[model samples]
Target: MNLALLFEDDFVSADRAVLTGRRLAHLNSVLKVSEGDLVPVGLVNGDIGTGLVVGLSDTEVVLQVELSEPPPSPLPLTLVLAMPRPKMFRRVLQTCASLGVKDIWLINAYKVEKSFWQTPWLSEENLRENKVLGLEQARDTLMPRVHIRKLFKPFVEDELPALLHNTRALVAHPGTDTPCPTHINEPATLCIGPEGGFTAYEVDKLVEAGCEAVHLGRRILRVETAVPVLVSRLFDACN
Candidate 1:
């Protein structure tokens, strides 16, 4: 982990944090840090700074932390994705977080398997865990919010319009006429469908809700691959 993420519960005092489990293991095996050494740390959804190792052991590590720097600016982009295959969903969440995507919406598409939603990775705890991994990888502290909408039609018809307000909204489709714009400055909401692509009716609904259908060339990229590519293309500083 690049930045050891400390939650509120991990803090023993105002300036000290204790880490165990996965973090401790990473320190021991990967970093091999010692007492008096400094490591990068950040409070979850708070600040980015350094931690001075005051104590270390097989079970846990204690650090004196100073959190003065704010986390990186979050992307003013909301990513709407059709639920991916369960096996790759965790990686997708991690990618989104690493790229500074602060808002994410997961909706069902015609090609999305109903069983995909049943994966344990979608559980609240697992979702947070994967996002943590992503945040640490990016050395960021601001946590991303994930919204789940199982019913696509209701979400498109009843909610997506307001979500697109004052933002450049685009839905990435492989065979569309318009190419995806690059390095946009304004806030944006991007919709990406499952690997098979969004059904025509669904794309129509999204268009009716204010999204312009756009393409990322002729290549069909997986959901995981497309997320970061689209984010980088749409933002000047994509984390």
Candidate 2:
């Protein structure tokens, strides 16, 4: 972990915080930090700063923190993605958070297996844990929000139009004529499909909801690879 992400529960006082569990292990093993050492730290959905290790032991570490710097600016992109395989989903979430994507929508596509949603990674506790890992990797504190929509048609017809408001909307399809636009300065809502890509009918629904169908050349990238690639392509800031 690049930064120790502190939650409200970690704080013992306004300036003091405690670390345990994975973070404590990281401190003892990975960082080999001790009392009097300073480490990068940040409060969740708060500022970035440093913490001085005032107390340390095998059980816990006490930090006196000072937060002054703001976290990285969030991307103005809303990601509407088809649920990926369970094995890849955690990595995708971490990548999205690291890339500063604050808004994420995981929707079902025709090719998406129903079993994908049943993964324990989607649980509230596990979701937060994965997001924390991502935030720490990026040295960012702002948490990304993940929205799950299991039914495809209802989400497209009912919710997607409102989400597309004031934002450029594009759906990444494999064989579409239009290339995915690059270095866009404006806010955008991007839709990506499952392993085999979205079915024709599913693509039509998304297009009808105001997304322009676009492609990333002839290569078919997996959802995990495509997310970072698309985000970097669309936003010059990511480059």
Candidate 3:
């Protein structure tokens, strides 16, 4: 972990926090920190700063924190993605958080397996755990919001139009005529399908909901790889 992400429960007082579990292990084994050392820390959904190690032991570490700096600006992009395989999905969540994607939609596509949603990684606790790893990796404190929509048609027809308001909407599909735009300054809503890509009817629904179908060249990439590439291409801040 690049930054120790402290939740409200970690705080003993306004300026003091306690570290245990994975973070304490990281301090003792990875960092080999002494009582006087300072480490990077950020409060969840709060500010970035440093923590001074005022107390240390095998089981816990006590920190005096001072938060002053704001976290990095979040990307003005809402990612609408097909649910990926469970193993890959966790990594994608981390990558999205690391890349500053604050809005994420995991929608089902024709190719997406029903079993994918049953994975324990989608559980509330696991979801927060993975997102925390991502935030810590990026030294960011603002948490990303994940919205799950299992019914594709209802989501596209009933909700997607409202999400497209005041944002450029694009669906990344292979063999499309329009190439994906680069370094866009405007907010964008990007839809990416499953491994085999979205079925024709699903693509039509998304397009009808106001997304322009665009291509990322002829090469096929896994969902995990495509997300970062697409985000970097669409936003100058990501690059």
- Per-structure clash totals for the candidates: 0, 0, 0
Using lDDT as the measure, name the better of candidate 1 and candidate 2: 2
TM-scores, in order shown? Answer: 0.98, 0.99, 0.98
User: lDDT by residue for model 2 over 80-114, one digit each (tens)?
Assistant: 98999999999999999999999999999889998
**Deviating ranges (above 4 Å) for candidate 3:** none
Clashing pairs in 1: none
Question: Across residues 101-151, which tens digit of lDDT does each residue of candidate 1 receive?
Answer: 989999999999989989999999999999999999999999999999999
Residue 153 error for model 2, in Å? 0.4
TM-score of 2: 0.99
After superposing candidate 2 on the true structure, give the runs of residues whose Cα lies further than 4 Å from its correct spot.
237-239
List runs of model 1 lying over 4 Å from the truth.
Answer: none
RMSD for all candidates, in order, please: 0.8, 0.8, 0.8
Per-residue accuracy of model 3 over 1-239 as CA lDDT, tens digit each = 99999999999999999999999999899999999999999999999999999999888999999999999999999999999999899999999999999999999999999999999999999999999999999999999999999999999999999999999999999988999999988999999999999988998999999999999999999999999999999986544
Shift of residue 238 alpha carbon in model 3, Å: 4.2
List the global CA lDDT of all models: 0.94, 0.95, 0.95
User: How many residue-pair clashes does candidate 2 contain?
Assistant: 0
